[model samples]
Target: MALPCAREVFTSIFKTGAVTKKFCGQLKQLGKVCNDAFVKKTLEDPIYKNLSESAIAKKSRKTWNTCASVIDISPSSSA
Candidate 1:
Protein backbone atom coordinates (compact mmCIF):
# COMPACT_ATOMS: atom_id res chain seq x y z
CA MET A 1 0.00 0.00 0.00
CA ALA A 2 2.67 2.46 -1.03
CA LEU A 3 0.58 5.41 -2.04
CA PRO A 4 2.89 7.91 -3.69
CA CYS A 5 0.23 10.58 -3.87
CA ALA A 6 -0.38 10.38 -0.13
CA ARG A 7 3.36 10.42 0.60
CA GLU A 8 3.85 13.52 -1.51
CA VAL A 9 1.09 15.39 0.28
CA PHE A 10 2.48 14.45 3.68
CA THR A 11 5.94 15.58 2.69
CA SER A 12 4.63 18.95 1.52
CA ILE A 13 2.74 19.53 4.78
CA PHE A 14 5.71 18.53 6.88
CA LYS A 15 8.11 20.72 4.92
CA THR A 16 5.85 23.76 5.17
CA GLY A 17 5.76 23.38 8.97
CA ALA A 18 1.96 23.74 8.82
CA VAL A 19 1.58 20.52 10.77
CA THR A 20 2.04 20.46 14.54
CA LYS A 21 2.88 17.71 17.02
CA LYS A 22 -0.53 17.37 18.67
CA PHE A 23 -2.91 18.90 16.10
CA CYS A 24 -3.20 17.55 12.56
CA GLY A 25 -5.79 19.86 10.96
CA GLN A 26 -3.62 19.98 7.83
CA LEU A 27 -4.48 16.34 7.25
CA LYS A 28 -8.13 17.06 6.49
CA GLN A 29 -7.55 17.80 2.82
CA LEU A 30 -4.75 15.31 2.56
CA GLY A 31 -6.95 12.63 4.05
CA LYS A 32 -9.76 13.35 1.61
CA VAL A 33 -7.49 13.45 -1.42
CA CYS A 34 -5.60 10.34 -0.33
CA ASN A 35 -8.79 8.43 0.30
CA ASP A 36 -10.15 9.33 -3.12
CA ALA A 37 -6.87 8.69 -4.89
CA PHE A 38 -6.20 5.43 -3.05
CA VAL A 39 -9.58 4.03 -3.98
CA LYS A 40 -9.10 5.04 -7.60
CA LYS A 41 -5.55 3.73 -7.75
CA THR A 42 -6.32 0.53 -5.85
CA LEU A 43 -9.10 -0.35 -8.25
CA GLU A 44 -6.75 0.13 -11.17
CA ASP A 45 -4.09 -2.12 -9.67
CA PRO A 46 -3.82 -5.56 -11.33
CA ILE A 47 -3.97 -7.31 -7.96
CA TYR A 48 -7.25 -5.60 -7.15
CA LYS A 49 -8.77 -6.83 -10.39
CA ASN A 50 -8.91 -10.47 -9.36
CA LEU A 51 -9.35 -9.65 -5.71
CA SER A 52 -12.38 -7.47 -6.41
CA GLU A 53 -13.89 -10.10 -8.64
CA SER A 54 -13.62 -12.76 -5.95
CA ALA A 55 -14.89 -10.37 -3.30
CA ILE A 56 -17.88 -9.50 -5.43
CA ALA A 57 -18.57 -13.16 -6.03
CA LYS A 58 -18.43 -13.87 -2.30
CA LYS A 59 -20.73 -10.94 -1.57
CA SER A 60 -23.24 -12.08 -4.17
CA ARG A 61 -23.25 -15.57 -2.69
CA LYS A 62 -24.56 -14.26 0.61
CA THR A 63 -28.29 -13.71 1.12
CA TRP A 64 -29.75 -10.76 3.01
CA ASN A 65 -33.31 -10.02 4.14
CA THR A 66 -35.10 -7.02 5.61
CA CYS A 67 -37.45 -7.26 8.54
CA ALA A 68 -41.18 -7.21 7.87
CA SER A 69 -42.84 -3.85 8.39
CA VAL A 70 -45.42 -3.32 11.12
CA ILE A 71 -48.48 -1.14 10.74
CA ASP A 72 -48.59 2.01 12.86
CA ILE A 73 -51.57 2.45 15.16
CA SER A 74 -51.05 6.16 15.88
CA PRO A 75 -53.82 8.58 14.86
CA SER A 76 -51.29 10.65 12.81
CA SER A 77 -50.38 7.53 10.87
CA SER A 78 -54.04 6.65 10.23
CA ALA A 79 -54.65 10.08 8.74
Candidate 2:
Protein backbone atom coordinates (compact mmCIF):
# COMPACT_ATOMS: atom_id res chain seq x y z
CA MET A 1 0.00 0.00 0.00
CA ALA A 2 1.90 2.99 1.31
CA LEU A 3 5.24 1.34 0.59
CA PRO A 4 4.36 1.02 -3.08
CA CYS A 5 3.83 4.75 -3.37
CA ALA A 6 6.63 5.86 -1.09
CA ARG A 7 8.91 6.52 -4.06
CA GLU A 8 6.23 8.62 -5.71
CA VAL A 9 5.75 10.68 -2.59
CA PHE A 10 9.48 11.05 -2.23
CA THR A 11 9.81 12.24 -5.80
CA SER A 12 6.90 14.65 -5.48
CA ILE A 13 8.43 16.10 -2.35
CA PHE A 14 11.73 16.61 -4.10
CA LYS A 15 10.40 18.02 -7.36
CA THR A 16 11.64 21.50 -6.54
CA GLY A 17 15.22 20.28 -7.12
CA ALA A 18 15.87 20.76 -3.43
CA VAL A 19 17.05 17.41 -2.10
CA THR A 20 17.99 18.56 1.37
CA LYS A 21 16.58 16.60 4.28
CA LYS A 22 15.13 19.72 5.84
CA PHE A 23 13.48 20.70 2.56
CA CYS A 24 11.94 17.26 2.12
CA GLY A 25 10.63 17.30 5.66
CA GLN A 26 8.96 20.62 5.02
CA LEU A 27 7.23 19.36 1.88
CA LYS A 28 5.82 16.34 3.74
CA GLN A 29 3.76 18.74 5.78
CA LEU A 30 1.72 19.56 2.67
CA GLY A 31 -1.50 17.96 1.25
CA LYS A 32 -2.82 14.44 0.76
CA VAL A 33 -1.47 11.81 -1.68
CA CYS A 34 -2.71 8.24 -1.19
CA ASN A 35 -5.08 5.99 0.76
CA ASP A 36 -4.50 5.65 4.49
CA ALA A 37 -5.00 1.89 4.95
CA PHE A 38 -1.31 0.93 5.19
CA VAL A 39 -0.43 4.07 7.07
CA LYS A 40 -3.13 3.23 9.60
CA LYS A 41 -1.86 -0.30 9.96
CA THR A 42 1.66 0.89 10.72
CA LEU A 43 0.37 3.30 13.31
CA GLU A 44 -2.42 1.30 14.97
CA ASP A 45 -1.24 -2.29 14.98
CA PRO A 46 0.33 -3.99 18.02
CA ILE A 47 3.89 -3.12 18.99
CA TYR A 48 5.17 -6.50 17.82
CA LYS A 49 3.12 -6.18 14.61
CA ASN A 50 3.31 -9.91 13.96
CA LEU A 51 0.51 -9.98 11.40
CA SER A 52 1.98 -7.04 9.57
CA GLU A 53 5.50 -8.41 9.62
CA SER A 54 4.28 -11.74 8.28
CA ALA A 55 4.15 -10.14 4.85
CA ILE A 56 7.70 -8.82 5.01
CA ALA A 57 10.89 -10.79 4.48
CA LYS A 58 12.89 -11.99 7.47
CA LYS A 59 15.95 -10.07 6.19
CA SER A 60 13.91 -6.90 6.56
CA ARG A 61 13.23 -7.35 10.24
CA LYS A 62 15.27 -4.26 11.00
CA THR A 63 12.81 -2.21 8.99
CA TRP A 64 9.96 -3.26 11.23
CA ASN A 65 12.06 -2.68 14.31
CA THR A 66 12.72 0.90 13.25
CA CYS A 67 9.05 1.45 12.46
CA ALA A 68 8.07 0.13 15.87
CA SER A 69 10.60 2.42 17.52
CA VAL A 70 9.21 5.45 15.69
CA ILE A 71 5.73 4.44 16.79
CA ASP A 72 6.86 4.03 20.36
CA ILE A 73 8.97 7.16 20.60
CA SER A 74 6.78 9.45 18.53
CA PRO A 75 3.28 8.02 18.37
CA SER A 76 1.82 11.40 17.56
CA SER A 77 4.01 11.84 14.47
CA SER A 78 4.10 8.18 13.36
CA ALA A 79 0.77 8.61 11.65
Candidate 3:
Protein backbone atom coordinates (compact mmCIF):
# COMPACT_ATOMS: atom_id res chain seq x y z
CA MET A 1 0.00 0.00 0.00
CA ALA A 2 2.96 2.32 0.00
CA LEU A 3 2.30 5.37 -2.18
CA PRO A 4 5.12 7.81 -1.60
CA CYS A 5 6.84 6.91 -4.86
CA ALA A 6 3.77 7.70 -6.93
CA ARG A 7 3.41 11.07 -5.26
CA GLU A 8 7.09 11.69 -5.85
CA VAL A 9 6.72 11.02 -9.59
CA PHE A 10 3.90 13.52 -10.01
CA THR A 11 5.70 16.12 -7.99
CA SER A 12 8.98 15.52 -9.83
CA ILE A 13 7.29 16.11 -13.16
CA PHE A 14 6.62 19.66 -12.06
CA LYS A 15 9.70 20.09 -9.93
CA THR A 16 12.26 18.74 -12.39
CA GLY A 17 10.39 20.11 -15.43
CA ALA A 18 11.18 16.90 -17.32
CA VAL A 19 11.63 13.21 -16.71
CA THR A 20 15.22 12.16 -15.98
CA LYS A 21 17.06 8.93 -15.15
CA LYS A 22 16.29 9.43 -11.49
CA PHE A 23 12.63 9.72 -12.34
CA CYS A 24 12.74 6.45 -14.21
CA GLY A 25 14.40 4.82 -11.23
CA GLN A 26 11.66 6.15 -9.03
CA LEU A 27 9.11 4.51 -11.32
CA LYS A 28 10.85 1.19 -10.95
CA GLN A 29 10.49 1.44 -7.21
CA LEU A 30 6.75 1.64 -7.65
CA GLY A 31 6.77 -2.15 -8.02
CA LYS A 32 7.28 -2.16 -4.29
CA VAL A 33 3.88 -0.55 -3.98
CA CYS A 34 0.87 -2.80 -4.14
CA ASN A 35 -1.13 -2.73 -7.35
CA ASP A 36 -4.43 -1.96 -5.66
CA ALA A 37 -3.05 0.94 -3.70
CA PHE A 38 -0.97 2.52 -6.43
CA VAL A 39 -3.22 1.76 -9.38
CA LYS A 40 -6.73 1.41 -8.00
CA LYS A 41 -6.58 4.18 -5.43
CA THR A 42 -3.90 6.81 -5.99
CA LEU A 43 -4.29 7.15 -9.75
CA GLU A 44 -8.04 7.34 -9.29
CA ASP A 45 -7.79 10.15 -6.77
CA PRO A 46 -9.91 13.16 -7.77
CA ILE A 47 -7.00 15.55 -7.82
CA TYR A 48 -5.09 13.31 -10.20
CA LYS A 49 -8.14 13.03 -12.42
CA ASN A 50 -8.51 16.79 -12.63
CA LEU A 51 -4.84 17.30 -13.37
CA SER A 52 -4.89 14.67 -16.12
CA GLU A 53 -7.99 16.17 -17.64
CA SER A 54 -6.61 19.68 -17.63
CA ALA A 55 -3.36 18.53 -19.16
CA ILE A 56 -5.05 16.71 -22.05
CA ALA A 57 -7.82 19.18 -22.78
CA LYS A 58 -7.40 21.06 -26.02
CA LYS A 59 -8.02 24.55 -24.77
CA SER A 60 -7.14 27.58 -26.77
CA ARG A 61 -5.80 30.44 -24.73
CA LYS A 62 -7.06 33.84 -25.72
CA THR A 63 -3.91 35.70 -24.83
CA TRP A 64 -0.22 35.15 -24.05
CA ASN A 65 -0.54 36.38 -20.45
CA THR A 66 -3.44 34.03 -19.73
CA CYS A 67 -1.51 30.99 -20.97
CA ALA A 68 1.18 31.53 -18.39
CA SER A 69 -1.42 31.81 -15.65
CA VAL A 70 -3.02 28.46 -16.49
CA ILE A 71 0.37 26.68 -16.69
CA ASP A 72 1.40 28.23 -13.38
CA ILE A 73 -1.71 27.10 -11.53
CA SER A 74 -2.18 23.51 -12.80
CA PRO A 75 1.07 21.78 -11.67
CA SER A 76 1.14 23.63 -8.33
CA SER A 77 -2.28 22.24 -7.45
CA SER A 78 -1.55 18.82 -8.97
CA ALA A 79 1.78 18.30 -7.25
lDDT leader:
3
Model 1, total clashes: 0
lDDT of each: 0.31, 0.33, 0.34
For model 1, the run of ten residues with the poorest summed lDDT: 63-72
Using TM-score as the measure, the top candidate is 3
lDDT of 3 by residue, 28-64 (tens): 4433233223433544677656455333221111111
Angstrom error at residue 45, model 3: 2.9
* Per-candidate clashes, comma-separated: 0, 0, 0
1-79 per-residue lDDT for model 2 (tens digits): 2343454433333222222343333223332222233344443556535444333222123333333343332212222
Write down the TM-score of every candidate. Answer: 0.28, 0.23, 0.29
Off by over 4 Å in 2: 3-58, 73-79
Count of backbone collisions within predicted model 3: 0
Best to worst by TM-score, what's the order?
Answer: 3, 1, 2
Q: What's the residue-level lDDT of 11 in candidate 2?
A: 35
Candidate no. 3 TM-score: 0.29
lDDT of 1 by residue, 1-79 (tens): 2355344433332222222312232333334344334445655777656545444322212100000011111111110
Q: Which portions of model 1 show Cα errors greater than 4 Å?
A: 1-29, 51-79
In model 2, which residue pairs have backbone atoms overlapping below 3 Å?
Answer: none
